[model samples]
Target chain A: MIIEGRTWLFGDKIDTDVLAPGYAMKLSPEGLAQHCLEAVDPDFAKLVKPGDIVVAGANFGLGSSREQAAISLATLGVGAVLAKSFARIFYRNAINIGLPVVAIDLTQEVAPGDILKLDLAAGTLTRLKDGYHRELQPMPPHIIDILEAGGLMAQLKQKRGL
Target chain B: MPQTLTQKIIARACGRTTVKPGEIVTVNVDLLMGQDASGPRRWRPRLEELNAKLWDPSKVVVVSDHYVPAVDAQSAEILNISRRFARDYGVKNFFDMQGISHAIMPERGLLRPGMFVAGGDSHTPTAGAFGCYAAGFGATDTTAIAITGETWTTVPETIKVQIDGALGPEITAKDVMLWLCREMGMENSFKSVEFMGSTVSAMSMSERLVMSNMAAELGAEAGIIGVDEITIEALKATGGDYEGAEAWVADPDAHYYKTVTLDVTKLGPQVAAPHAPENTDDVGAFAAVKVDQCYIGACVGAKLEDLQMAASVLRGHRVSPDTRLLVAPATVRVTEQAAADGTLATLTAAGAILLPSGCGACAGMGAGIIAEGEVCLSTTNRNFQGRMGHKDASVYLASPYTVAASAVTGHITDPRELRTSTRNAA
Candidate 1:
């Protein structure tokens, strides 16, 4: 339930349309990440390294229920998405797809390219540089159970042997 | 506890008498919906992984809508995947040539009152107009539901939106929703939204769908409308033998987290400016902004009456030389009806280009895509920074009437202004 990675900062109200632009929808699953955030950060697909973290302001993923928003990020191998807040469906999609999303006030704590650590189990986040940190509010137990099993699908498979 | 509609519906789906906000419960979905753009992407292979046939094929509805006429080999592949899933799983309600499921489901009697419907596409909330607790979920969730006919949700509190008085003759549900978002903001983001009052009861299913579909813009869990005689009669009129309709009204003492009321008589046509749906203003204040394209597409905006409104505005008039008008009907049945009623001919004579019966410009998938740096007054939902292909191609969301009126003037003109102007701008 703990992850550490480089930071990729974005602003508030990042919608799903730009998260995975509709024009790039025909691309294969992994190819979707290639266009992730290309509207705002044209070089995101070319520049993002695996296991990176994305931090943003309030109402992150504030648009459609296109799972592409979360899938594109998952395909990019993001460690977690730390935001001031999240739109409800996007929050559910992230957890259902095994992406740890925490709502916390961390916009002033870390900078882009800074290494930060997140602990979903203990509800905490720590900046690897200055060791500055804060605790996050834990998700509900049912959601935590899904995240702990690596996502809803894996959790369902494990529990029901589907 | 006094139950809101969300509590009542969720309780019924979960086999409980009552439920509360943030209570996670397993639900028995009455129907599962998947669109061509999203369904074929995952569910088929996932069902194979689970070694399962569909829990009950009769309850599944798959509509090939997003990329109709097959934009490419890839689009055809997705369409074929939907067909294969339907055929292989024995899903009885598969409609490939129907244009859009949001309109087709209700028109075909698949959507009804007192049902728990879940779909893969975001605009699936449109189905909630029939008094269903319907909302959009992802493909993975669709896979799980296909396997077990069940899903889970954390029940949300209700934000009851009441529409009082009569709507102005020029006003449409699109304006009503934009006004609500502008006034309340997305403050009701995580709550269930119910549209009620005299204005709503008088509005047709199309009008109600327009209001419910915008609920997603509020980030609502489900945009709900209570079932009344209008709902039942709309179904009966469909000629599809829709007899299962039931009345599901909120109790008189229903508990709502918040109540917001609007007198439509006092409200006029409204429009949302570029980049956000909540940043809205009256159409009368919009005059000098020239437009490159005027589009009417998506399930929310492209119904029969919407086309009729646009056609009436453009009856003998031609579209301005500088502006291009694109009409994409939400369903094939709507297109046929318009054709039968001469609405299509009127629009075509006015120089409107008709796209397939699906989401054409809404996602910038095929036709109606605009150039960079151009401004478009569109009827589709979402005016995100890069929504319609190019990030700089601005889309101003409004009702079909506002879009049509703007088309005549080649600028953002008010629909009410067209009441006097007899001729189109040259």
Candidate 2:
């Protein structure tokens, strides 16, 4: 699948609290989704449309491992997460929940609002139209299996005949 | 060709007899996990669309940690929904109001060496203290574990933290971790960190737990203090039911991506400022900052030793009239024993407000939130802006002693400075 979206660039260590702040957590996922990235960029949620990608620096998803962080992004229709690195929990949670999370090392060249296309199978993140194209280390085949099946539960259901 | 504990655990889980450094392997997991704030409820419809059933029951764990004691009716209802899901799914490893899942997992024997673990909680990596290939996942990923007992991991390159020197009295593992979080930014190593030092060898099981528990705060995929006598004793005390107790340490020549050193002598009381946990500096840096709330509880603060340290500082001295002090025990056992030992009495008599034995008020799940612009000095992990209930509220993360001393004086003050008032009252 080639995911086409606008890029929302964030620096390293963008924590869960900032992604989906705790105060907003009391609200529903949709409600919280509106405030996603409000702590960093107040206009983030209001300006973005569906199929957007969040490109971040190293250690993305750095605190609490709260699924709300991933859910907030997904509900906002963020098609995928591209980071230099991901916090272990956030990375797994994102993939399990079917949010495509990819890692590329050239975070220095990616800019916010740059339209990009991510070919999950090709391990290529190409800047659509004006963005730069960079290759990423693709997730393993089994992980692609899990992601394609729409996370762990679906993968298990297919495997165990559930 | 020595293998690191991480390599060994990953290799074993994947059925590979040996794992050389930097070789990637797919592994099966022993357990999958999630908690309330970031559970699979929103993703449930997606799972249904995908036509999935719960995976292996024995390998799944769901906890109601972030909103325990269900502060508001909404939170209570949310927890009820989670509980109903746990019951309907026949998932037996559910923990509600028991304590932080990271703290309770080891107590319940779910974390063991040579096992791979993933949780929806970032601190899920806390289980790596058991020498397991443990990491945290997001809700979507946890939904996979809830339905499947495996996760894919690129074998992480290991980083070694070798600590030495002696820990002074009042210096706890929390300080060591905070020191690491500071030295290594909250994402310092990216993945795989193992702690080995003379000081680590000298630390108790409780101390090591604290050290590994906060490893995620540094953005590590997993953190471990090499298994030794203390680990064996700790596992035994927690019910010795684990099968691979001896397989918890690394071989001597294991490869590491980077190696760091902490002398322990250079460490002191650490405090993380609001909006970020890694904004940690020496506690003394905030000596004049006023506090509106003082909280001591959560996975880190609930230890008996932590309470005793706070009690020792608060003994005979009253908390400041403007300050509110919230004391929560990490576990029921610690809560019960503290009451029996009069430690609870000493804290309460000194004007500390007692809360239940869960992760109360730490994650802003219930109570203890400060007013807008108010500042709170807390003993829990995470000081991210807007973390403590109100987006405008500010929090300073500190050690238990610093929290108590600051509470008594209504401002940040070193514990040593409070000795005069405590002695005068006596």
TM-score of each: 0.96, 0.90
Write model 1 residue lDDT over A1-162, tens digit each, in one string: 778889999988888888988888888878888888988899887887777899998789987778889999988889899888888778888988999988875777778899988888888888887989787886788888888898888987886765
As a whole number from 0 to 100, the lDDT of residue B171 in candidate 1 is 86
Per-candidate TM-score, chain A:
0.95, 0.91
Q: CA lDDT of each candidate?
A: 0.85, 0.78
Which residues of candidate 2, in runs, are more than 4 Å off? A3-7, A104-139, A142-162, B39-55, B242-244, B420-426
lDDT of 1 by residue, B1-426 (tens): 778777888899999888988788999999999888778557877777767778888888998887776878998888899888888889778998687888888888777677888898877788888888998888778878888899988888898998899888878899999988888776355688998999998898889989889998887868999888888888888753346555477777988888998888988889899898998999866677899999998888899999998998888778999899999998888999999999999999999999888877787676787778999999988898878879888889999988998898899988777866553443
Which consecutive 10 residues in model 2 chain B have the weakest lDDT in total? B38-47
In model 1, which regions exceed 4 Å deviation?
A160-162, B239-246, B423-426
Best by lDDT: 1
Candidate 2 positional error at A157, Å: 5.6
Candidate 2 C-alpha lDDT tens digits along B1-426: 687888888887878877755465656878777777766454466567667667777777887777777767888887887788788777798888777787778877776666788776667767776776777766666665565555556777788999999987677788777778879877654468898889988887667777777887877778876667777777778774555667678888887888997798867777888777778888778877989889998887677778988999888789999888999888777787789999999999999988876666667666676778889888887888667766788888878888888988898877766776667777
CAPRI classification of candidate 1 = medium
